[model samples]
Target: MTARDEIPLRDADQVMRLSRMGSFHQSRLSFMRILLRRMRNENWQFDAPDWHVNENGVGRAVYTVHGPSRAYSLVAFAHDLPDEMRSDRVIATAWDTTFTLFDGIPTDDDIARLAQNVPLQEAGRISVRELTLSRANRSARLWDFVVANLSAGRQPDPESLKTVGYVMRTTAVYGSGKFGAADHGTIQDRPEFAAPFQAEMLTVYLIRCFVMDLLDHNAKCAGGKRAVKLSPKLRRALGIGNSTGLGMAPFLVNHPTLLHQWIAARETALARVRGIKTVTDGERDVMIHHAKSAHINAMNWHSQHPMQIAKVTELQSDMVMLCKEITRIGDAPYPWDRLYRWAAQNLTSEGLEQVVSILMEPYGDVVDDLADAMSIDESAHFYIDGTQAMGHVKSLIAKHFDWALKTDFGAGDEQARFWYVSAAKLEPRLGERDAEQGHELEQPLAIGRDVAALYRAITQDETVAHFLRKHPEHRHILRRVQMVEKFPYAEIRDNLLHAQMMPIDMLRCKLSFFGATHFDPRSDRWLRICMFQNAPFPDELYVPGNWVYPEPTGAI
Candidate 1:
């Protein structure tokens, strides 16, 4: 349907705001669901060929999945990391377990080769046969408690499972040629890996399986004949945990076209759903069921960050109000649209986004195809449009960067933060411009401020080529200005360098797109999240429907 025939997509200014982007919720178009749906449709097969861990949980395992054309194996090396050495920070040297997603079943030599490097992380180097290199630290209290309880011939408390959703939280999962692994370009053409981060997602999924298996192995080793396997419901609840920080924040800014496709796909999905004038009884039931499920999830969501705690409280209240108000659903014309409007008027941003997510649940046929459109040939947008006149560039900025122009970066507080790469781990870090020493070496992440500077330096009459020839430094932002003309969601409108800017906003926006849930922020800089929670393991791929959302009973 054309824009005139349906609700137009939300305005970029409104959608791209940090607050709204931060409030984003996973939908039918999320990458994780897309990957699982494909694998299930293809009837993939999974098996563990090797498990040699001992009572001390120090050994290796090989879990592999055979897809339509190829097989990928997660070769896991478990270690008995000392309590003093375990840390979630990227700079940490040792982990409880290390893994590499090998291109296929590895031979004894290949396993031996990886064991030497995988645990060393950044210091170690893997070969091109490896697709991903990752490491994880056990959730100490939960791991020990579960082992202790299971070793004594009993299940760990479900309440404890609810509190700590994962046995191990991945500190890092490196892919795409990082540390000598096979580049994404090598596998992007494979149907199973065509979607964004499919390899990485699969890596994490298989890792979850291994972690579960490891727990069982450890229990049997600790308590000989009495050890038992976890119930399917409990097993499904344990997802792989991820500790993400400022390092991920630059990805959205650096890959503007890709970011645009992601946001645009979700917006287009929302627009299509809002366009429906008639809602079938089945669609209505589905919406109500998912809303109720989401409410349960919100109630169970835990966070220590003050802002996140307040937002979750507001969301719990919003869900209560929504449940009561939805009784009037049949009275409204364009009920989904009307519900969205009501949410905007009555709910917090967090609540409003939850409404958007649940609205897309029943309309999968209308929105699922949009995931195909989420990947962009970002290289196509990398070239500078040198032929455009300076006046044209200025006009483009005026149209797309009005928020940047209004920002007063000259003020110390307004320009208080800068993004830089840490020397210790070579990861991105946000530094205070007033207290930190590296503002001069700031990464190009502060696009809004740089665009403002570019606006001031240009003259209307000159060509972009002419201006850049004299001032080479404006070249990067000039390309961004040109790219934004076609990809409106290319730039975050807020001043990222401002003291008030929250890197967590960027993290939440990206993670939600990956279909993560139960965000529990540890600080404003980094957060802990669960991925594939309540999702079917690869062996149970035949039935993954609605696994991303929790059941009303709070079981998988």
Candidate 2:
């Protein structure tokens, strides 16, 4: 039985709102949703193999997962290290441990071969079979406590989750042909894995379970006959921790079409929910219920980032007032639409958008319908449409991208910096246009200033093909202009060259929809996040899909 056959359409203006997008809450549209969906539908199975660790949880481990259509394994390499090696930054080479998500179940040879390559990361070359690659360091705060408690056959105190939530914090999860790994093109169409980041997600999902088993194994090794397997409930408490900084900021800008598709799908889902002329009384009740669950989740969301803290405050307050109206106007006309209006006025940018996100849950039939289209082949459309006329490009820039023009950019503050790729790890970094020296090697990601320049330059040409022939160097932005002709919200209008560029807003816009809670901004550049905070464990996969709304404690 195939689900998700319908596509929801959103209001373009509402979807394009910058602040609203930054405020987007997770919904059925999140990657975690798809991962859980596929896991249940396919009935994927996992098994533990050789868990060679001392009582201290040090050594190699291998676990394999059998999906509906294929087999892959997670090979975790653990090493003892001093405390100083625990940094989550990209430059740090030595970690407490390293892990690789391999393409298939490994033979003894394959495991030995991986032992030679996976740890070296960029330095040691890998073959095509290494599907999704990543590395993580243990959370010093929680790892020892978890192993210690489990060894004694006791659950770790729940309060430990408040400060540091996850066991293994992934530094980076690399996929799609990075570092000699096979691209998604290699096997994305296999019945089991078809979406963007699906392979990477599979790695993280299995790793979540592996963290539990790995810790359990270490406990057993320590306790000999006394080591206790983790209780099912406590195992569910573990989530895969990801320490992401500004590195993700580039993808949102570089893949403008994909970004537009994601936001558009989210908006379309929201609009579709609002457009439902008549839903069952049960359905209306479900919406009110989930809206309250989202509110509770928002209340527990702990983030010190002033902007995010302010948004959380608004979301909590708005939910209190909004839920009252939802109950009072039980049979009200245009309930969804009216709620949206109330939110737009009363809620913060993130809060209002978060409401739009949670509203999609009651109408899963609508959001799920749009899931297949969420994945995009960015490489397919990299080339500019030379056949397009300059007049068409001009009209596209003028009509769809006026936001890029309206900004007062290129001033001393506005143009204070340029975005460049860090040579050490090949990650994105921001440097001053004047204060920093390496502006010459800038990556072609700044869309606002360059698109404005393209708008001006196109006027001098008769045809876009002629213009491209004259200056093929600006082909990237030219392709983007053509893409935006159809995808209006494709380009974020913020000028990357400016000092005031809020990269956190860009990250928040993407991560929020991923169902991530607690946006801890370590700095404007990078931060920490917790996923599946109130989410259910894998055993609950066969339960109803609406579990995202229900608290783990069974409230709402």
Candidate 3:
């Protein structure tokens, strides 16, 4: 068969299930990879125009990247946060460092203004010239080890680096009109900001560079002439860690159109790769090479949480099976499709999703363009079609939300949890419906439960406009039902209020799109992940090809 007879996209019923969504791995289309690829292709230039930190690591530095049309700078401020004051929670007011991604190269006067407010975070204010605001704390376990060893002119153990993964972990990275920063609408027209989260991804990438530089400077000051800089390979292995919590879980539910575009882009890429009628020897070899690297990545992945530990264990076994199976498959026609079909039946969801990511590794020419289509003007889909008949609406509900229709929301387990905004921090929080006093103030995140209610409320054979006038409570869900008709992957096929529901599953799904790796869950509500791990720094962007997985020899 020809490529024109491409494999159809996977059904939303199969792909949108929370179990499968949570099992997703980063692919070539991940936002981080997309940003890096663009930077490399455009021949972007990076430099540190100023570094004024003292031996105490208390000062400000500026790192800038000159793109084809514009220059953006990361103005980072280092603080001497006491051990007692350090915290990863949003309620905390202090951090080891705070940064903002300035829209362009900022002048000395602009720096003076930023210095006054950036460190105060939420309590501070920024102008529209800023794109993002973020803060990170040093890792308690790995920070001292690296500092002591580097100060003594010795390299920290690679095993230790592998164990902890990063010197600092960002507690939060705020953007998109947050804290007076420029709204996404202002920057969406720019070519560099075309893709979703490109600005935030760029901010994190530069932060990685700043973290390495700070470590080197602090070590030199402590040991005088005896200190040494980190080797390039070891530095490359370190990534910027992030502590993500329940606050991120609502994104996928709230931004239906955007979520659909992201998932649709990925699903399209997978279908294109699976449609290949012939696999060349070179393509087959590249697949095997990355498969081995993926195996090593899985082996080195560590997590203390029981759920993640079990998933990682299964992933390790799946990689081994995949390596042996891919080699034996040989040069068969439609080899990728054949391997994917086999994996679906033999492997767990974690391994099965990894196979999907690996299949696209050899076909960048076919899939990379999908990155451009990932962003959406969600406002265009906001208008409701009030003229549609109730029968048509019922059919749309049946087609897209069958899982919700089947669920018994009346049961205690089905409606056990409620999502709320915490009064103190104004962050999204999950609470027990039965035991909590604030169930009366719950947010409208229970899409499944609401859809079920909408289904019951639709007792008349009339237009949505007429039906809604009599029962206005169903207006929100009716808009969602209509939206899902055009966007198949828009709604997650699960009951968000179910007692067994894991919010980490929602967090993992979003982070994977950001190209995060090493998902170490701290609890059912939050997790820690490493970003740009094994990825090239700005100076090393000239080196090309897939860098998501580590070399076998260098594997920890």
Candidate 4:
């Protein structure tokens, strides 16, 4: 494609809006897909060298994956807790299972040491030899149903599987030095973990494997001679579930440079696909197949929250419209770009972003490489140019923080919410500014509001160095302001403290990048989502195809 035919990346202001970002769908660039593609290409091998669980399901098992140059093992400890004690809250002290990803294969002594700590979760301490620490609780209803049916030599009802996608849902997956696990810096240079969250994603992937095996073992013990194994089709239908809350919302705000890299890479991929001058017949077929599968996924996606219910309803309609539009693509130049422009005009933000994701499905060769660019050494962007003129800083604010400048923060609703860390768990929480206490200890996550205040504080033309001498409070935002001048997509262009701002939107934006689906919000503050649903297990990694969306015939 020539320069004239090539489309430019979408503007940050248009693309970084919280509403649009929340509407994003996973494409081939998602970390999970990137990790899976690499494992398959390298011909990784997976095995469970140790399975010590008894009939009561209270024992330990180790699942390990041998890669090209390294091996990581997931050390899992199963518990037989009473149903009343099982909870998904962060404060919960017990779980159905707990796990830690070891840097390499662990010996009996290493396993014994981990056995004492992994199950304790937050109360436990790990060493640098571990990469991640996590805990999960079983979906009591689905677990019971599946186990009972399988033990009696029967498959689970597909509709029941559809209603609750996973047998167990992880409440928390702590990594990167949290709870004393290995830091990202220690493992980042490794080829396997070069992409963001590959270590954690691999942990969850292997956990899924263990979860399936544990279920099979329990069924055999209960039924004796009549027990049957879960079919591969049903096994592929389930995935690891995750419960996320406000703790994740501030991440997008705290790591501006890293967030920019992710958004820029995705936008670049979309631009490249849109620039394609013509689509071959095989490429067109791939698009049609994924589009139909996306439609089925939309129809199958379930949520009880009114907001998500409405969004899913709109997405279903959008997919139908998209499939019909795909049928009309004839011998037109730049057909993908044409379809994108049509979507921009005709569809809602939800449908429009869906089209952007679907368009990239047929062009993996052009987009897959972008995954490598998703991660960065954020410390390189930490230095502030204190010598910059105050005039230049104000102009940067004018160009990037116009949305913040125009907002009326003095209004009660404009600043109704405040984010703060709870003293008990030290996790981020939101409170009503007017009715709630602890607004005095608010965190520095209200970036737009802070930028507005910084603009007002600049009263004279001088160097930023001199300004910081008198007012050091503006230092944090000043660094961010300078960063945004170089990275346009570095900031989320919205008021995070507004009363109407749904934290779920921020959570969904980050989770979608992790390749999560079935966003079921339990409330505005927290939600349940499924990861790797319809994805192949490690044993089936050799099978090649896009498995993010289910096949039409596989739909419930």
Where in model 4 is the C-alpha error above 4 Å? 1-5, 553-556
Q: Per-residue lDDT tens digits of candidate 3, residues 218-336? A: 98988779999988989999999999999999999999999999999999988988888887788888888888888988998999999999999999999999999999886767888
What is candidate 2's lDDT per residue for 1-556, written digit by digit as tens? 1123233465455565555556666778887777778788788777756676665667777878788767888888777778976678888767766777788888889889888877776666667988867787888768888878878877788767655667778888888888888877778677556655777777777667667777888777766676688776555555677888888988788778888878777777777777655556787777777777777666666677776677678778877876786676555556677677777777767667767776777776666867787777777767777777888888888876676777667568867888888887678888988888898888897777777778878755477789988878778888888887778768776567777667776787787656666677766777777665445556677866454443433443
Q: What TM-score, computed on C-alpha atoms, does each candidate reach?
A: 0.97, 0.92, 0.98, 0.98
**Best first by lDDT, ranked:** 3, 4, 1, 2
- Name every residue pair that clashes in candidate 1: none
lDDT of each: 0.87, 0.73, 0.91, 0.90
Off by over 4 Å in 2: 1-14, 223-229, 534-536, 545-556
Better of 2 and 4 by TM-score: 4
Please give the lDDT score at residue 174 for candidate 1: 91
Which is the winner by lDDT between candidate 2 and candidate 3? 3
Model 2 TM-score, 2 decimals: 0.92
lDDT comparison, 1 vs 4, better candidate? 4
